[model samples]
Target: IAHGEIFLTTGGRSMDRRQIWSAMKRLCQKAGVAPSKVFPHNLRHLFATAYYRVYHDIVKLADMLGHSSIETTRIYLIESGAEHQRQLERLGLVS
Candidate 1:
C-alpha cells in the first residue's frame, strides 16, 4: 500500500481477514452471487485446480503456490464432486 509493502489480495490494501471478507461480501452482493459461496480461499482453490488441470504438473503447481511440499499442493488439486462429475460427462465416460 505504501512505498515498500506489498499486498497479495486485490484492492492493494493491507487488509485483515475481516476486511477482506466484508469487501468480498459486498462484491458478491453486487454480482448477485450468494455471499456464502465466495471467499478468498475459493478463488485460490479455483486457481490451483485450473492451473494444475492445464499443466498436469503437481511440482509446478506447488512451486507456483509457494507450497513447500507436494502433499500441500494435493489439497489444492482436489475439487468438488459435482465439478468432477461434470468433467466425467464431458469426457463421455458417464454416458
Candidate 2:
C-alpha cells in the first residue's frame, strides 16, 4: 500500500484489517453503539444500498462494486421491512 493511502499506523507499520476492525468496534462502543453491531463488511453493504437508492442503476453499481453477478450485488441492497413500508406509503395509493 502507498504511504498516502495509509490512515492508521502503529510503530511505523500500517494497521492490518483485524486492527482496523477492532478500532472501529472500540470507537462505536465509545459512541454508545453496540460493538457487536459494528462490522467492516457492513460498511460495504451500507454503501451499496445508499448508492443504489440514489442512482437506481444496478448494472453500474454491480460493476463499481466488482461483483461478477448482479445477483450478488442485489444481496447488498436488501431493505428493512420498515423502510419498505415507508416507500409503499410514499406511493399514496391508499387513504
Candidate 3:
C-alpha cells in the first residue's frame, strides 16, 4: 500500500473510486449479498454509526470524518425506525 492510499490494485497502483465500487459490488455478489445495499459510501455510514454507539462522541467523529460541523456528522448517526423501536422495547415502559 502506498502512503495515503486505502486500497490498491493487483498491480500496486491506487484504486480509483469506480474501481473500489466495482470491487465491492463483485465481492457482494460472490457473498450472496445484495450489491445495491453495499457500497463504499455506505460503509462510511456504517462505520460512523457503530463508532458513535461505542463512543457517543460526535465532535470527535466529525473530526475523524473531516467535517467542519458536527451537524453533518449527526446525519450519519440517525437511527433507523426499527432500531429506535428496539431501544424503546428494551425500556420496558410499553409492556
Candidate 4:
C-alpha cells in the first residue's frame, strides 16, 4: 500500500538518483511547475524550516528529520529567507 511496501514487493529494489530525478521531472510537469523551480529536497527543507519556525524546538526537528545531530538540522534554517522579511516588517521598515 505504501511506497516502502511496494518496494519490498518488487524485490527491495532501489532507484538511483537519475531515476529519481526523471520521476520528479515527470511529476513536476504534470503539476505545471518548472523542474528547475521544484527541487525534491526543498520539500524536506520547507518542512523542517516551518516546523522550527512554529515550534522553535531544535530537538523535535532533529527527531522528525531523522538527523543524528542537531547541527545537521540547523542547515534547513538557512532556507528561511522569509524570516528576514518578517523581521524587517515588524521593525516598520516595510509595509
Best lDDT among the predictions, by candidate number: 3
Query: Which is better, 1 or 2, measured by TM-score?
Result: 2
lDDT of 2 by residue, 1-95 (tens): 53343546757666777987988898998999988899888877888988998999999999978899999999888878999999899999976
lDDT of 3: 0.92
Stretches of model 1 off by over 4 angstroms after superposition: 1-13, 93-95
Query: Which candidate tops TM-score?
Result: 3
Residue 59 of model 4, lDDT score? 98
After superposition on all C-alphas, the RMSD of every candidate to the true structure, in Å, is 4.1, 3.2, 2.0, 4.3
lDDT of each residue in 1-95, candidate 3, tens digit only = 33377788999889988999999999999999998898899988988999999999999999989899999999998888999999999999998
Give all TM-scores, in the order shown: 0.67, 0.75, 0.87, 0.60
Reference-based lDDT, residue 60, model 4: 91
Model 2 residue runs over 4 Å out of place are 1-15
Write out the backbone clash pairs for model 3: none
Worst 10 residues of 3 by lDDT: 1-10
lDDT of 4 at 25: 86
Q: Taking the tens digit of each residue's C-alpha lDDT, what string does model 4 give over 4-86?
A: 42212245666655666677788999999998976657767888878888999999999977899999998888745697788
TM-score of 4: 0.60
